[model samples]
Target: MPLSESTVLISEVGPRDGLQSVKSVMPTAAKCAWIDALHAAGLREIEIGSFVPARRLPQMADVADVVRHALALPGWTVMALVPNLQGAEAALATGVHKLTLPVSASEAHSLANVRKTRADMLAELRRIVALRDAQAPAVRIEVGLSTAFGCTLQGPVPEDEVLRLAEAAAAAGVDEVGLSDTTGMAQPAQVRRLFTRLRAALGERAGAAHLHNTRGLGLANCLAAYEAGVRTFDSSQAGLGGCPYAPGASGNVVTEDLVFMFEAMGIATGVDLEALLAARAPLRAGLPGEPLYGMLPEAGLPLGFTYADGRLPRTPSIPRQAAA
Candidate 1:
């Protein structure tokens, strides 16, 4: 059966989420090139990088520079992740179109990841939202209720608590709030239920679905969220990020595969699956020997596969990348 929804936003997160977890560092110019290619392929919103301190995440040391380059591109929404009020301020200074703050619903994960309790994180959200309103009201603030599905440290995150946080975030003055399966513990049923409850709680303020492909259910969970009325999604190109459950394990749902899923369903993504796949050239070149993963690239499109527009990828010719 065809999906009821006809449009979806595949927000690319490989620059921030994917690179941060990887040991190798992609150069700043290469990062800009990758972002350019991504935008060229029709991804409107791209999480170009994060605003954390360089000592903490060296891979994102030149975030401001990358953001500057992305800003120059026309018709693209530049997004960056901020860990707290401080990072949020820096991200705002970059004049980014969007800023994302991740708060873990799981108490243990909160303490482990950000070294703050859930209450403390909420407090930070309050302060960040206030700062954003006072300084840059034009910039959109997004709060990701991270680890909502389940936590690697605490496990079994309650649905009520997740909904409560979403309410709190909405009340805290954020422009939007979304659920994140940081540990890839989200099942399809859980996704549908939680998204429905979140929509009930926050109404139209409920935001994107940031899912991990851990255990190979990323695409399934995304579909479930879509059926629940979600239109925006966060995915890493080539599945570049790691799984928190295994600490250094594989990545988020592959962007190429996710786009393929939506386009194959007659849903419009506006992304050229072939061009998006070709964008991986810069990624591989940036992080040589990093071992990228994706289904579309390996198996190739199955026989008779066609995009939502009834067109196939431009060509089977592979994209070439500059030496790292």
Candidate 2:
């Protein structure tokens, strides 16, 4: 299906990818409120949580609860990350709208992160697809090839390996295949070329760009991908995640900055900037003392700027007390 000019889907991954890397766990009530506020801001798709073992990632221990709450929201395409078939089963049981499986294009990173070889990860992908087919026909499966741009462990990851994994993910019966700059080493030129090639390889199934700002090129890279005809962009509320194994790296692209960039250019992201900022308050309250990153929120909106929707700039009026 062709991407419509009216809207771009910016799937928020803060609850899942953002919180996972943090040391503190966001309370369930706070998480539910955050999801609701994001939905109110016109964000239709959200990665609610990841279905990993609670013992391994305590931050996402309430994945099931979060998924349930997000599913309750109308028009929300709730998503969850599943590492393998086991995680896939758990996510399916929660009736999430989508399930994403991580497949590393870098052999070294794959081994280090998931303790599985590249071939083993592909095998697991096939198993997860089979399980999805059997149990949840409505659930869309996305294979996110991590370290597609470059790997910290192995230095330079070849483009051929990334293509190979994309083909493998499609052959393994995934609905979509996405590329991730897990190590934050991607450049805009590289993003354009790779996403172009992926479009040719996967056709309509080419998935969103999951980028990082560790090297400060995340937004630039995303713009390149957008120029290359990518419509879906994955971002976090406050830029909340990073590879726990890879130190000094930023997580996914910040949602606030991404929304601002698109809306400023009249790209029509369908997300309200003010409401998006309002969503951040709950995130801040949830993860106290944790650092939240966003350029738009810090710099404020551009002078005399207005959104295409025309609902902004009008602050909700507070009811006044009756005169005595």
Candidate 3:
């Protein structure tokens, strides 16, 4: 089913971004189960995995199988992350609905994360776009300006550079460009200003807000993004991941808490909070003994709480991160 105009599009990245940080590989069957549960809970867009070398990210070795499984689900938008033209080719072959690439605004981070200078990455983006235009014209390509706010390796990314990259990405024929708080150095003030500038610069082509909860301000930054007219968001289930390349960059905005915040404020997230909370079970089963983050699971919904669309509340049930 198509989302209503008021619905906030939350792209769940637990399977891709979340798993890439972990050492243990989640069994293929378990990954499918977790994704199935998420889809059942009304999450329409999901980044199932990345198209990287298995030796580098063994956790995602079964990405193609995961994509095939996710594609079987009706009305689901299955996305995948690709670091270069090579990765993009693999993802495109899997028939993914969308492909997201990370382009850092910080020069140091660009080298560290993708081993490419900003200009090289732009060249890569153009190559990927050309390939998509020829091979899979229907697939959408999105670029996330990673380390847009700040960088641990480089420290304090400039706003002008970020906007410049966004313009470059748009000019490269990407469907959209969004800002990512890759190192979790963003404050609410900074988030608002950047996203506001993003909208002003890219208009409808401005994409999701991929915020991190590293400093415990994930929700605050998310709200700031919303207030700045950002409707799409990228979150991880159970707050499962962060940038493995970004030192000390831990925690993604928790999907459960994010959904609750929007739903409680009379904003339609279109996610069934109870169902979303229940999806945590499969994740836990997949990664035994892994510590999950998110306050909504630990604390049940408040009394008489109602969703934005007037969905009645239910009593809740409950449920992080490490090396690159």
Q: Of the candidates shown, which would achieve the greatest lDDT relative to the real structure?
A: 3
Tens digit of per-residue lDDT, candidate 3, span 215-254: 9999999999988988999999999999889899999999
Candidate order, TM-score descending? 3, 2, 1
Error of 1 at 95 (Å): 0.4
- Name the runs in model 3 displaced over 4 angstroms: 1-6, 314-324
Give the TM-scores of the predictions, in the order they appear.
0.93, 0.94, 0.96
Tens digits of per-residue lDDT for model 2 on 1-324? 125664578989888889888889889999998888999998988988888889989988999988998888897788999988888888898899899988888888888888899999899989988898988888899988888999888888999889988998899999999999988999999999999999999999999999999888999999999988889999998899977655555667999999988877777888888889889888888888999898877767765666755545445322233121
Candidate 2: minimum summed lDDT over ten consecutive residues — where? 315-324
Of the candidates numbered 2 and 3, which has the greater TM-score value? Answer: 3
Instruction: Tell how far residue 93 is off in model 2, in angstroms.
Output: 0.7
> Each prediction's Cα RMSD?
4.3, 4.8, 4.3
User: Given candidate 1, what's the lDDT at residue 10?
Assistant: 87
lDDT of each: 0.86, 0.86, 0.92
What lDDT does model 3 reach? 0.92
TM-score head-to-head 1 vs 2, winner: 2
Q: Flag clash pairs in model 1.
A: 241-251
